[model samples]
Target: MSGLLHPFIQLGYGLEFKCEALIACALAQASTHRKQFSRALDTETFDEIRAGDLDGGNGLSLLDIMELMRIDPITDKITYDDDPYTEENRALSQTLAIKYAKLWSVGNSESSVREKSIEVMSVIALVYGSLTRPGYRPVLEFGVMHNLTSSYFLPILLDALPLHKKVRLLHAYAFTFIYIFATKGCPPLHIPPELTLADTHRAESAESSSSGNPWMEVIDKAIANNDMHVAKVVRALWRLSLLTAFPTQPNASKGYELPPYINCLYLARITVDSINMSTRRDSVTDKLQLTAQDGRRNWAHGMVAYDEFWAKYGQAL
Candidate 1:
């Protein structure tokens, strides 16, 4: 019990507690004071886990509590749900926890900027599942984090991985997480019941045919129009695509460069839900252009803010 309970105690205490303290507390509660530890794993545990107030591990980790309670030699009811803890639920919860913990740990580890960035990216990739709507669904629909954090993780994570790895991971993570998010229309931080593999694949195929292929379509249109401005926008989009292909700076010379394509993307975003012929033309007008200086400033500001944020609360990542 002490061994199994240690992670929970650590997580409940926000992992800020020392290992020795965690051991002491867990043993003291579960063994010396069995009543207290039992209560700790009861309804009270749910709030701490939900709030992320726990320490070394997530409060609801399958390995830490759910699995132990379900798979133990004992045969008593454990979960808050009225239903008994079934093998299926236990397995699903454990799979989720293990993957969640690994990525969460990476985003929380003590490492260099480059290493930390890579880990963060990997974590995002793991969460997103693919580059399409299917991959992004789980994270976005989970609403566990705001769309800003949830949607951005993939692009950022791809920045950290090796160029070769990023492309593949991006495809997988983006497709899975995006599919979860877009279809469900949920916020980033929430979680849903089990999502089937078939539904996810179907969503991926549909998105690939239309929305995911928007850039190439736009480029083709730009080429036919002989529009330099539109051509530049396409070029920028092409560059932004590279960012996902190779997320992080490989060396000193390969520092961050803002992709100019986002201007058109953002413009598209502001008007996607509404369709006015005049407004559409106006949005595409020359004034809609985004300048390099604007891009540089925005990139620099974001980078500085991210670095500062990590430097201050890096342990929590």
Candidate 2:
């Protein structure tokens, strides 16, 4: 989860393409970043929780755990001014994140793994789409965007692991999600109203005559764009759309329940459109490179002020 998710992402790519060298490089990268959170992540308490020994042995769903983090007073008090990466702050945040995250049980069955993976993917996508401030230029926050992209690797990583390791990975991933939400000023999450299948069809049909299929348009733009983030996000969202095409009732037993409004296709469209609009107004390449040089300044690592975010790239109403 550290290194702004680079190691995790690299490992995903390695698993995805079956590249041993990339996998090795990712492990090497991960080794370097583990010490900072080792105290928080490597404790017996967390291990017990991960093993389903706590919370009645049937932990909360991932979304439920997220809600807990959102409403927790302590998390709400954490702000960008607090400098969350400092050793003291990082330890505190990680402990809190792990506390909430442990309440989400990683079920033992393969079916449970699939369900949890989809749930994680859906929740992150919902967050990415929902974080945009109303009346703004619709630019997705760079920091929040990584959560969505990094989650793309979950299914890939889980598929190759055994049941025990799968549980461990899921626990760590859930913890990372909570930690990010807390550190990013605990931004309010306002998920849009549910988009029924009919609603999505009508919306797509309305745009198809002139645009020739909204999904294709998004895919085309993503492929043509030089931005890796653009391509990765589009691809991930497209996969999510397929995985979540058939809406299901919220079943607490499965530990995965998506809200009615979280249509992956709709979210994907919004993401690409926002990225396009944002890039047109600024040098995304330059900004990405400059931020990459300093991880803290990188849009994915820092806290962006809401007002500054609204006016980023000199964008006007």
Candidate 3:
């Protein structure tokens, strides 16, 4: 097999350089400036480049073309999502990935941040579709599934706005694709369990009955895992915690204090999207044991606040 494969690999590479020279010559005419190669290429017909479906084009092997485009699997940082590299298209997967990682780290302001993140994600989706070969349809489909499902959290998670506003944004994004996926019999897709944020109030329910700090314990475990999504969720919760019953400075006034359990549910629902069925069962058991003395009224009020907040900010996004 190696004997046959060695010759095939050599032949494939020969085809690639032959394609590259032709592309370089064709695109060179589009620009007098040699430095404009990437920009000029970016504007060219990319369909055949993407699908390797062109007739009598360059006869370049898909892997060879991708290699010349700097998508060589062994040496290049960017992995192939698709096939042939064309004279008209330039690779931007690595560029966009670097940009996203930076934005995610610095954190954006509420309204502007959401818009920017969506734009970035759109670029990512397009590039993924355009650069891969037709044979990679499943891999591409899986990527789309993962991205769209995971993206459900952005509007809610990043919005510095109130709970209701976030939920409305979430619902809008969710409603766009939720029905289609649900009809296929998928549960409203859950974020990876490690990625979902637990509200401090929810975290505290068991501990409030015991003598310990339930929410803090949860944080400790989350930290030990060192998960980025979990950490981001924790940051959002900390900001929300100021509004909840969690302990803070004594000087903190009304709006900054803890709200109700209902509010926790509303926020959690928005921020995390799909509820874990098991967690819901635990919630029911906890709710059953509650008395008028057990803080349900406060929880109820929080839900109201969430509703009111959502009403005001829902359309902002």
Candidate 4:
């Protein structure tokens, strides 16, 4: 959660929603109170265990890892305290969040500077502007942090959240957490649900209305342009994003069910495999991996803001 938020803040989009992610991380970290994860997971033992788990080369059971790491598990329901929005705080749909983000990444007051900057700037402004007004954080749709902080422990509630919110959570997990865990190596923050397309399709379809697969759209565009390199990146992003949204069970191929956190190494194994495929995959991924890892700590540092910019503007390149 902090990983995703602090980066956006440094990127000059200090919207409250991004702040919410950090706050959520702190609150959840402190939820146990007896032994704060903030203090415990920092020790060398935990880091060694994290690395050792990867070296073992086996199934990464999040439940077993959580027991070892002593990270509290969320197994219930939780929501934001404030619903003072213009409308409601009903989990900002992922589609809506992306849509709003896309909308924000555009012209503002009719006299903005630079052409390309407008798109990204508009998104920052939309979220930031909506946030300054007191009752719009929930309306704008950036619950990646909320879910990260809360959802890991309470995956049962994933369906309750709006489609956009679910998408935001998946985006954060794959783009931020999983990426960091795989390359830079870090403790797994939260475990995404290990459900499958079959596991979640019914509910997600009902909630999202199947507005044509977003992943397919990306793939289609790449094929149309004859850009295999772009296709590789897009495919990697799609794989991670999809995992966040509909993670397969531990033995998904063999058939299993899980809503548990696994080993960081095992998680990383799956994630890196997901991201680094296709002949076109190459060193360009280093930059993306760095962004995911660095964006967490470092405050006004560790920034990784250009993913959306690149994804949206891939055609220009």
Q: Which candidate number has the best TM-score?
A: 2
Writing each residue's lDDT as its tens digit, candidate 1 over 281-311 gives 2355646442332111111111111233224
Error of 3 at 184 (Å): 27
Residues 16-40, candidate 2: write the lDDT tens digits. Answer: 9999999999989987764656655
Q: What is the TM-score of each candidate against the true structure?
A: 0.21, 0.77, 0.21, 0.22
- What range of 10 consecutive residues in model 1 has the weakest lDDT sum? 296-305
In candidate 2, how many Å is residue 138 off? 1.9
Collision pairs in model 2: 194-261
Q: Which ten residues in a row are the worst by lDDT in model 4?
A: 295-304
Scored by lDDT, model 1 comes in at 0.29
Query: Please, what are the lDDT tens digits per residue for candidate 4 over residues 149-233?
Result: 2222222222334644433332232222222211111122222233111222221232565465443444555454332323433
Clashes of 1: 54
Error of 4 at 207 (Å): 36
Query: Which residue ranges in model 4 land beyond 4 Å of their true spot?
Result: 3-37, 48-80, 83-317
Q: How badly does each model clash, as a count of residue pairs? A: 54, 1, 16, 12
